[model samples]
Target: MNILGLSCFYHDAAAVLLQDGDLVAAAEEERFSRVKHDHGFPKHAISYCLSEGGITAQDIDYVVFYEKPLLKFERILSSTLGTYPMSWGVFRESMITWFNDKLWIKGQILGELGIETEKLLFVEHHLSHAASTFFASPYKEAAILTVDGVGEWTTTTIGKATADWDGSGENKIDLLNEIRYPHSLGLLYSAFTAFLGFRVNNGEYKVMGMAPYGKPTRIEDVHKVIRVAADGSFDLDMDYFSFHRSTNRAFSSKFEQLFGEPRVHDSVFYTPTTHPNGDHPDWDRDVAAINQNYADIAASIQAVTEDTLLKMCENAYDTTGSNNLCLAGGVALNSVANGRIMRESSFDSVFVQPAPGDSGGALGAALYAHHVLLGNKRKFVQEHAYLGKQYTADEIKNTLDNAGIYYKHFDNDDVMAESMASDLNEGKVISVARGRFEWGPRALGNRSILADPRRDEMKEIVNTKIKFREPFRPFAPAILERFASDYYQLSDAEKLYPLRYMLAVYPTKDDKGSNIPAVTHFGGTGRVQTVRNEWNTLYHSVIEKFWEKTGVPVVLNTSFNLRGEPIVNTPSDAISTFSRSGIDSLYLGNYLIKK
Candidate 1:
C-alpha cells in the first residue's frame, strides 16, 4: 500500500511516501524551491515523492497531514479572545492569512494532487511530532518525548511505544501525559532569539551558537521575567512577553527596559557602520566568558528540558518496561541535550531519527497512518538517510551541457577524493557536491564546503571567503564513525541513530580535545558528524583521503550555500552556488569546477 504524509502551512514544509510501511522518499519544499524556510504547500516535494514512489495520486491508499488544522485554528481564535482588545491586531492579521490560505490545507493539498478529500486524516501536531520520533527510531519499544512551538494545543508531550502482537506484530504509539502550551522551551528560546536582534524561529540556532559568546550576566533579568515554580515546572512571567497579547509578541515594554535592548535585525550586520565584527573585537575574553555563560544557559535550558521530560520518559519506561527510548520533535534537534540525557537517563538505549524536526513530520505522519491507522503489520526500518535523488555521470553532464557551463569529469572517484583531500591538507577550501542531497537542515558531506581544521585561517576562509556569514560562528567536522568514540564520549552511539548533519556537539575525548585550532570551539566542544562507510561511500572516502594526507581524520564541513540560501539541490544549483560565492572549487558528482 502507498501512503503519503504531509506537513505544510508552516515552516519546513515537506512530504514523505511510504510503501508497505517502509518510507520511500522524503523532501523538504525549501530544497526544491530554493526558498529558505518556505512555509507554503510542498507541491514540488509532494510531486517528487509521488514520482519516486512510482505511484499516482490515486494509488496512494491514505493521506495523513502532520497536524489538525481546525484545532490549531481554534487555539488561535481562542487565544485572541482571551487577550481580547490587547491582541486584536494580531488576531486580525493572523485570521486574514489563515482565511486567505492556511485554513484550507486539506482542500489545497487534495486539489493540488487531484486526490479525494476523504483519503486525508489529520493528526495532532505534537502527536505527529511524537510519532515521527518513535516510529522512525531504531527502538521497537521506547519512551517518547516531544517539544516544539505550540502545535494545536500541545507544546510538549511524553508518550510510550510498544511492539504489539495484538493479533499481529505491529508497533503502536500510546500516549501517557503531556505539558501543554502558553509555556514552552521552544517559545522561550524564540523569545530570546527575538530579544537578541535575530529572527525568532529561524534565528534560534544563532542564539544557541551566539550564547557561547555572551555572558548570561542577564540571567537574573531573565529570572525576573520568567518565573520558575517549585515543582520543577515554570510559566512565562506574562507581563514581559507580548506574543500572546498582540501579533507583536509576548514581551512587554517593561520587559525590554529591564533587558537593556531590543532585538537586532539581520540587515544591520550588513551595513558598514554597524558591522557586527567591527563593533566587537573578534575575541574579547569577556565575550568568551559570555559565550561560556550561554553554553551554561544552554546547559540550564537542556537541563530543565530533560528534567521535566524525564518525568514522562521514566513514567513511560516504568509502564512499558522498554529498555529503549525514542526521541523526536524540534527539541530532539538538540544534540548537546541528547548527549547529556544519554549519559544520565534511565533508558538502556535511545534512537533519534535524523530529521527530528518538522521536516521529518511528513515521514512520521505517513508511517503512523500506514502501519497503525491502516492495520498493516509490515515492519519497515530505515537504515540511512541517502533516500533522496541521485544522478549519474550522463545526467550530470547533460545538466551542465544544457546550462552551457564548463566542467571536467574525473577518471576515478578515488583520484578526485585524493586530489581534493590533498588540497585541503594544504589548506585549500573545496566545496563538495558529490552525492544525493541530505534530507534535513544539515548538508552532510554531499553538499558541503571542506577545509583543514589545523589551518588557523581555514574557518575564516570558509566563512568570510565562501559562506559570507558571521565570523564568530564555527563549522562542524565530519569524522569517521569508527574514530568518533576515540574523539568524542559517544559511549551510547550504539543507541543513537547515526547523525550525518552537524546538529549536536560532543566534548573531545582524550577524553580531552586536541588543539585542532580551527574546528574545536572555545568551550572545548565540537559538533561532529559521524559518517559510516556503507551509507555515503564517496563522501566518506573523501574524509578518509583527508585523513591519509593530514592524519587528523577530520575535515571542516559547512553547508554549501551562500548566507540566507538553502543548501544546493540540483547540478545547476551547485554551479550557481560555486560561481556566486567565494568557493575556490566545487566537486559536483564525478566532475569538478575549479575557478
Candidate 2:
C-alpha cells in the first residue's frame, strides 16, 4: 500500500511517502524551495517524495493530512471570541487566512493531487505527534508525551501506547490527559523567545544555547506568568501574553513591566568587555550589561521550561506506570531540557523522533494511517535519518563540471574518507555533501561541516568564519558509537536512543572531554551524536580515520549551510553554498574540491 502524508499551511511544511508501513521518502519543503520555514502547500516536497518513491499520485492508496482544519479553526474562532473586543484585529486576520487556505484543506489536497475526497483523511495534531514517536520507536509499549504550541485547542498530551497481537500486531495509543490552548508551555517559551530579540519558533534554540552563559536569577519573576501544578499541569496568565488577541506581539505591556524593556531585534548579542587575553579596546560597558541581562532572562526561561517538563514527565510516568517514554513535538527539540529529563525524570528510556517539529508530523500522519487506522502490524522502526534524496557520483560530477569548479576525483571510499579526515586534522573546515541529506533540522553526517574538535579555537572559527552566526552557539560532536561511553557520562548507555539523533545533552568525562573543548559547552555538557558504522559507513569511517590520526575519536559537526539557509539538498546547492561560505574544502560524493 502506498500512503502519502502531508503537513502544510503551517511552518516547516513537508511530505512523506510510506510503502507497506515503511517510510520510503520524507523531506521538508524548505530544502527544495530554499525558503526557510515555508508554510505554503508543499508542492515541491510532495513532488520530490513521489519521484523518490517512483510513484505517482494515482498510485497512492491513502492521503493523510497532519491535522484537522475544522477543529483548528474552531479553536481560533473560540479564542478570538473569548477575548472579544480586544481580539477583533486577530479575528479578522485569522478569518482571512482560514477562508483563503485552512478551511479548504481537504479540497485543496484533492485539487492539487487529483485524489478523490474519500481517499483523503485527517488526524488530530497531538495524535500525529504521539504516533510519530511511538510507532517509529523500537519499543513495544511506552508512555507517550507530546507538547507544542496550540494544536486544535490542545497543547500537550500524555498517553500510553502498547503493541498488541490479535492475530496481527497493532499499536494502540490512548491519550490519558491533556492541557488545552492559550495555556501552552510552547507559546510561553515563544513569547520569551520574541522578547529576547529573537524570532519566535526560529530562535528558541538560540535561547537554549545562550542559557548556559547566565544565571537563572529571574526565574522567580517568570513564575508570575506561568503556574504549574505538582502533577505537571500548567496554566498561563493570559493578561501578560497577547498571542491570542493580537498578531503584532506575543507579550503585552505588563510583561515588559515584569521584565524590563524588550531587546530590539537589531541590537548586538552578548560580548565580554575583557577578553581572556586582555581588555578589548572597543568593548562597550553599557552593551555588555544589557547583553548580560538578556542572557539572565534566557537562563530563567530555560530553567522554568526544564522544571515544567520534568513535572510533566513525572506525571506521565505516574499515570502510565511505564519506564519507557516517547517524546514528540516542537518543544522536544530543546536538548538541554531533554538531557535534564533523561537524568532527573522517572522514565529510564526516552525515544525522540529526529524531526519532532511539524515536519515530522508528515511522517507521523502516514505512520498513523498505516499502523493505527488501517490495522497494520508494527514492523518498521526508524534506525537512521537518511531518508531524503541522494545523488550518484556521476550526477555530482556533472554539477561540479557545469559549475566549472576546480576539483579532484577519487574512486575508493576509504581514500576519500582518509583525505577528508586529513584535511580536518589540519584544522581546515570541510563541508561534506555525500549520500542522502538528513530528514530533520540537524545535519548529521551526510550534509555537515566538519572540523577538529580537539582545538578550543575551532568552535569560534566555525561559528564566525564559516557559519557567520552567534559566537556563543556551541557545535555538536559526532563520535563513534563505540567510544561514546568513554567520553560521555551515559548512565543507561545500553538503551538510550536520544543520543543517536542528538536529541539530548550528556555530560562529558572531565578526563576525556577536556581534550576536546570545541564541542563541549560551558557547563561541561555536549549534544553528542553517536555514529554507528551501520548508520552511515562512510561518515563513520571519516571519524574513525580522524581518530586513528589524532586519537580524539570525535569531530566537530554543524549543518552544511551558511546562516539563514537550509542544509544543502542537491549537489548544485552544495556547490553554491561552498562557493559563498568560508568552508575550505567541499567533498561531494567521491570527488573533492579545495578552495
Candidate 3:
C-alpha cells in the first residue's frame, strides 16, 4: 500500500511518501520553494515525493495529514475567547486565517491530491511527534516525550510506545499525561528567545548558542514567569506573556520589567568573554555589558529548560520503567537539553530522528496510519537521513557547465575524498554536495561545509566569511563513529542514534577540547555527528583521510548554505550558494569546482 503524509499551514511544511511501511521519500517545502521555513501547503514537496517514489497521486492509497485542523482551530478559538478583549486582534486574525485556509484542510488535501474522502486521515499533533521517533527507532518499546510550542491544545506529552517488529505484538502509543497550551516550556523558552533579540521559532537555536557566554545569574528572575513542579509539569504566569493575546510580541511589559529590557534585534552580540583581548571592531563597554546581560538571560532560560527536561525524562522513566527513550518535537532539537537527558536521566539510551520537528510529523503521520490504523507491522528503521533527492553526475555537470564554472571530475569516491581532505588540511573551506540532501536542519556531512577542526581561526573564517552567521555559533564536529568516544564524553557513541543525527551535545574530553577548538563551544561542549563508513563512504573516507593527515579524527562541519536560507536542495542550488558564499571549493557528486 502507498501512503502520503503531509504537514502544512505551519512552519517547516513537509511531505513524505511511504510504500509498504517503508519511507520512500521525505523533504521540507522550504528546500524546494527556496523560502526559509515555508509554512504554506507543501505542493512542491508533495510533487517531489511523488516523483521520487515514481508514483502519481492516484497511486497513493491513503493521504494522512500530520494534525487535526479542526481540533487546532478549536484550541485557537477557545484561547482567544478566554482572553476576551485583550485578544481581539488575535481572534480577528485567527478567524480570517482559519476560515480562509486552515479549517478546510481536508478539502484542500482532497482537492490537491484528487483523493477520495475515505482515503483522507488526520492524526493528533503530539501523537504524530511521538510516532515520528518511536516508530523510526530501533527499540521495540520505549518511553516517549514530545514537547513543542502549543500543538492544538497540548504543549507536552509523556507516553509509552510499543512497536510490532516481528508481528508478535501490536503497535501502540499511549500518551498518558499532557501539559496544555498557555503553560508551555517551549513557549517560555521562545519568549526568552524574542527577548534576547531573536525570532521566536527561527532564532531559538541562536539563544542556545548565546547561552554559553555568560552564567545563569538570572535564573531566579526567569522562575518568576513560570513555575515548574517536581514532575516537570509547569504553568506560565499569563500576565507575563502576551503570545496568546497579541500577534506582534511574545512577552508582556511585565516580562520586560522582570528581565530588565529586551535586546535590540539583529544587533552585534559581543561580550568580554567573546573578545577577551577587546579586539571587537565595535567595542563599546556599555554595549558589551548589555550583550552580556542578554547572554545571561539566555543562559538562565537554557538552564531552566535543561532542568525541566531532565525532570520530565526522570518522570517518564519512573512511570514507564523503560531503559529506552524516544524524543520528538521542536523542543527535542535542543541539543544541550538532550545531552543532559542522556547523561543525567535514568534512560540508558535515547533515539531522536534526524527531523524531530513538524517535518518529521509528516513521516509519523504515514507511519501511524500504516502501523496502527492499517495494522501493518513496522518494518523500516531510519538508519540515515539521506532520504531527499540525489542528483546524478550528469545533472551536476550540466549545472556547472551551464553556469560557466571551472571544475574537475573524479571517477572514484576515494580520489574525491582524498582531494577534499587535502583541501581542508590546507585551510581551504570546502562545501560537499554529494548524494541526497539531509532531511533535517543539520547538514550531516552530505550537505556540509568542511574545515580543519584543529585550526581555531577556521571558526571565525567560516562564520564571518563563509556562512555570514553569528561568530559565536559553534560548528559541529563530524567525527568517525569509532573515534567519537575518544574526543566526546558520550559512551557507546557508535550505537547512539542522536549522535548520528547531531541531535545531542556532549562535553569534550578534558585533553581533547584544545585539539578541536574550532568545533568546541564556549562551554567546551560539541554537537558531535558520529559518522560510520556504511552511512556515507565518501564522507567517512574524507574524515578518515583528514585523521590520517592530522591527528584529530574530526572536521568542522556547518550547513552548506548562506545564513537565512534553507540548505541547498539541487545541484543548481548548490552552485548558487557556492558562488555566493566564501567557500573555497565545491564538490557536487563526481565533479569539483574551485573558486
Q: Largest TM-score belongs to which candidate?
A: 3
Q: Which residue runs of candidate 3 sit more than 4 Å off their true CA positions?
A: none
1-595 per-residue lDDT for model 2 (tens digits) = 9999899887799999999888889999999899998878999989988998899999989999999989999999999999989999999999999999899999889999998988998998999999889989988889999999878888999999987444445578999999999999999999999998889979999889878877899999999999989988999998899999998899999999999999888366764521333244545777777878888899999999999999999999999999999999999999988988998999878999999999888988998899888988877889999988899878988888888888899989999999989999999999999888889899999999999999999988998888899778899999998888899998546467888888899999989878999999987999989898999999999999999999989999999988888899999999889888889999998898999
| Residues forming the 10-long window of minimal summed lDDT in candidate 3 | 488-497
Clashes of each: 17, 0, 0
Clashes of 1: 17
**Which scores better on TM-score, 1 or 2?**
2
lDDT (Cα, tens digit) per residue for candidate 1, span 248-278 = 5646788767754554455222212113353
Residues 69-157, model 3: lDDT tens digits: 88899899999999999999999998999999998899989999998999999999999999999989999899999999978899999
Query: How much does each candidate deviate from the true structure in C-alpha RMSD?
Result: 3.6, 1.5, 0.8
Predictions in order: lDDT: 0.73, 0.90, 0.92
Better of 1 and 2 by lDDT: 2
Candidate 2 whole-model C-alpha lDDT, 0 to 1: 0.90
Cand. 2 TM to true fold: 0.98
Q: After superposition, how far is residue 459 of candidate 1 from its true place, in Å?
A: 1.5
**Which residue pairs overlap in candidate 2's backbone?**
none
